[model samples]
Target: MGDENRTGMTEFYFRPFSSLPKVQLLIFLILLLMYMVSVCGNGTIVLIVCTDCSLHTPMYFFLANLAAMEICYSTIIAPLTLANLTSLRKATISLAGCGIQMFFFIFLGGAGCVLLAFMAYDRYVAICHPLRYTIIMSWTVCVSIVAASLALGFLVSLNMTILIFHLPFCGTNEIYHFFCDIPAILHLLACSNTHAHQVALYICSVINVAIPFLLICFSYAFIVVTILRISSGAGWHRTFSTCSSHLMVVALMYGCSSFIYLRPSSSYSPEQGRVVSVVYTFVTPVLNPLIYSMRNKELKDALSRALGRKVLHQSK
Candidate 1:
């Protein structure tokens, strides 16, 4: 089903991993476990934040949004990846389906990036300016930040998707990577004079990934400075504890994404890109809930209470 037209491309096929069947099987199993964990883990975070009254605050509000984004992010790619791995025949995706996948992948990913930055800001306020933290991070402001993050994410992703898909894919219908990401798609483009397109992609990456990452770092820089100014050892420990989880999440999300998107398309390697993509797309989501739950005692206690209530209701 490899037909090309003047308007747009129709469908695309995915290249199977070059490894042996046993290796493919192992990869499939690992991806399956990762998918389940990402879903369940992020799902639990969302559920606990929603049901637990104690978690009804700006920090947890942003966290719930992040968890929801992670769930959506994993769902967009992981299931299709699993199906492709298990299928006997080569995996094919319709042009419309491919566009949709790319859209959500970028959308949720961008939202998560901004959301993490907001979480850092949240901690910054809570720690560095504890006196006016409540007034500064009111419920109204929190909701506005979330709405802005979602809107900004959609705007950037829409621009990138439109720009990438507008190019003709007349050469090869086979995508070398596991998913329909920008770098992978650009690598398959049969067009000439793609310098402008690549430049636009790099710009988008800079604005979305690199900038937010810098903002997170900036917020934490101030946070660390403010923490050190305090004399109490307990104060230092408490301040650091609040932000450690967010810092870890920022490192994981930005590290892989920046590597994939921040560079020129000429440097794109399908095999390396696929492996690195696994980090942010699959592994990071699974690790996020674990990182947060493990580091945040408040979250752990909230989870316990939520589970306890579930057990109590079921036993009745």
Candidate 2:
């Protein structure tokens, strides 16, 4: 009865969440909380950076950009994922819709990586050459860096998305992973001899993943060496404190990215890939504002003062 034969029928099967039994429910709840947290948390960061006169430095400037990108990045994929968990329908997306999602996801994600690298270079100049920090990280240079990052992000993501979307997805429409990542889409293609597509994937990996990671790595390496050379213990602590939060963010972002995208696509099992994708895509954005706001004294004091003023006005 279950195996009734039909003519020219394409049986669509949804990937089941039953694969991850114990932790599936827990992860879903946490991700829902994260979506709200990242939205509100990053929004507050942007507001404080904009309003506070004293906080208008190179670090906060970059922080504002990072927060903005986190909002964009999380918005692209997290809502759909949460819907898939909560609703009855396993929310199907059309090919065009999937392409649009991939574009913003990659674009904002790429931009975030670039800005983080720039932030590291900012710390490097600030600590290693305090005398020249202001001149080096001038207003013009900061604007240029942010602009270049956004430009490169859009260009690279546009190319990759266009190339991947052009491939005919005639065979199967079901993507195994939770969201519309390139590697996840590749798995659904019915075409044989995908050599050309694989080549494009490799090229994108080099540009979007490999190169930016190397830049981040080199920036931190320089930062560490400079921190070590500081003569006094107090001076060393002061220097390390400045960049430690950024370093934590860098670690989590890069670690999750490497797990999801750096490995051979053949190695990612469907269920495992979805789980790992949740880490970098959903989890990392939620962590960004908390890492910076909690650890950085300036942001905390600014936020507290802003809230206290509001409370006072309300009482009056």
Best by lDDT: 1
Candidate 2: pairs in clash: none
| Residue 82 accuracy (lDDT) in model 2 | 72
lDDT of 2 by residue, 219-311 (tens): 778878987787899987777678889999988887777776677767867777777877787778888889998789889999999999999
lDDT by residue (1-316, candidate 1, tens digit) is 1233336567787877755788889999998999999999999999999989999999999999999999999999998998999888888998888889999898889888988888888998998888999999999999999999999889989988877777768777888888898888877755655778889888878877998989898998998899879999998888778888888998898999988998667788888898899899899999999999999999999989878988999999
lDDT values of the candidates?
0.87, 0.79
Off by over 4 Å in 1: 1-9
Instruction: Please list all clashing residue pairs in model 1, or write none if there are none.
Output: none
Candidate 2, which segments miss by more than 4 Å at Cα?
1-16, 19-28
